[model samples]
Target chain A: MHEWALVDAVASAAETAAEQEKLKKVDAVVVVLGELQNVDRAAARRLFAELRKTKKKALHRARLEIRAEKAVFRCRACGKTFGLRDLNKLSHKESEAVHFLPEMAHVYTECPACASRDFEIARGRGIYVREIRGER
Target chain B: MTDPRVFSIGMRLSKVRRIIAVTGWKGGIGKSSIACALALALAKAGLKTGLLDADFTGASCHVILGARRSFPKEIEGLEPPLVAGVKFMSASFFSGGRAVALRGEEITQSLLEIFCVTQWRELDYLIIDLPPGISDASLDIIRLVPRAEMLVVTTPSVLAEETLRRSLKLFRAMRIPVAGTVMNMADRNGRAVGDKPLDRVPFDSGYEKTLGNPRALAASKLFKAVARLAAKLDAGMVRN
Candidate 1:
């Protein structure tokens, strides 16, 4: 149910593009889902599928494909970048905690170079529909 | 996201064998009457049946079912009141005749809460009367209950063909089985409605009148049509 918002966001974005292109028969909608978003995959797919019925002209024959973008973190103190793999380089408990607190990773682990607890998410924090395929 | 308790509670409840949503391509296509009639006819067949009035904003299933009043009770969870020999749930029970002043996330969450808390009795068939067109409520039901099948309802008007086709094609793309399409208010003498002609609803004033007066609904053409559709639904269930 919480994921309905995300599903609506994806559908709304696709409809916006479809309206701009004036495409009548969208073949598919491609969405980039951020891992940090932790959306329910099946629920999102069903929502997108149901939306296809209402947005008929905009998304005719539309299918949803959610490609998950992995989370990447950048150290604000040292300006270095890393991914979830780096988070796993910590103690087993700390690594597991990353799943729940990915945004606050700087609190548990220090920057490898500057040893500072200040960092910002550089990538994989965005969930957006990257492309929509119309009758082609 | 729903609370973990909601998921567990919903899982604990028994599963209905089949969930069919009767949806219209557009409003004023008699979606609710067909749904209510189908449910009644199915119930007449001695099957355990339930009808969910899912049109939160414009709920009228209770009216069609002639459920004059309901007693809200809580056992382990909310139990749907019985109406006309069928287990029934409707948003009208909660909001009365007044409009539900809800929008966006509130509507979606209300539906989710209903699905989570309502403890339905075991049913062989659970028919859902959906709001016209695809919407947040419809999508919530689709996403929440993956086993649901959709039945598209449309009139034989030339204006409705394109819209109906779009709906059917959408179910195809989404991998949802459309049992068949119901052409409402088709001419009694028409040869056929579509390729297979699952059922046809003739524009009968008696049937329309019966909607407000339940006792007036006595084996009319509409009744037989819905009964025939129920038989077809059984065949569809078996095929699946």
Candidate 2:
């Protein structure tokens, strides 16, 4: 599953942070999923749980926390600010494409006000590792 | 907050032995053609190879290789489909041949997503067809794939040669290893741009018709020239 790859990244990042901080055991990790990417939280949590067991000892017992951020786009040509819900509905194929590579949003979507493709993903564009807490 | 994708890129590429980025500073200089042909040549020589069309907005390797428009399978991650015995991945599969307009930051994000999610398992040579110029894709490739060696391509025109020299200087300043240069579409009597040794590929008038036909492309004069260059690269691998 694609989520497995993403979850693996989260685990890998947490492990690296734990090692750098000289943590003996990682207690929790917080991950944020941007709305534009639309990652499945349940799948990410499950995969992270499964992946932690195979990682280093510091990450073996790490708990995974998931969060979502609303997607916002600002047009460069017309100075229009909008959300994904304000744009035209995407086809199943287009949505799937954006799910894999969120940058595909620019290919399929345009600014609702001016119909311009030039826009900035002002917020909520990708998956990120928010925080990692551990015991030294 | 940190992007976790950056941390896993090295792990994803751990099994790949060599990464050769085919690049040129100018467009229409045959970077894609050379990259695709080089991949085919390496595969023909019985080496495990993968070709990644990193020119997200202007992806043409899929067209050159005649690869079908099929989504890569998701097994642990997206696995590049095998096309003509070479593992192939491109943004064309996602865009469905539509034009993708992206800013520099968006390009970097998409590139990171690709490097983080795609799995190229145990490849002997992974050829990256880069976009033209020292833009986001080229700069990010240098930042992301530290082990990648540049295979510069240029035409016989003085304009192309001037840009090639500038690119070479930039690469040297960055301390990037240039595997070699290829003088593509050169005249029979044309000399190498500089004192450095370079492989020359004479212009093949019939090369255009061979596009989208892997068999014909493999049998073309262009392919034969690239195959000779591939042999040199393979030999250099042994020396290294």
- Model 1 chain A: weakest 10-residue lDDT segment is A95-104
lDDT of 1 by residue, B1-240 (tens): 112222332352357887888887689988898888888888888888888888877788877767857743554335778777788877666553544544544456456545644667588898889888887777777777766788888877766666787877777788876777888887754344345454677877677667655445646778787788898888774222
> Candidate 1: deviation at residue A129, Å?
29
Question: Which segments of model 2 are wrong by more than 4 Å?
Answer: B237-240
For model 2, how does the per-residue alpha-carbon lDDT over A9-100 read when each residue is reduced to its tens digit? Answer: 99999989999999999999998889999999888888988999988999998899888899999999999999999999999999999989
The TM-score between candidate 1 and the true structure equals: 0.60
Q: What is the lDDT of candidate 1?
A: 0.67
Please identify model 1 stretches exceeding 4 Å from their true place: A1-136, B5-13, B188-196, B237-240
Model 1 agreement with the true structure over A45-135: per-residue lDDT tens digits: 8977876676546675689987888877677767988766675355554443233223324435555667655666556643566778885
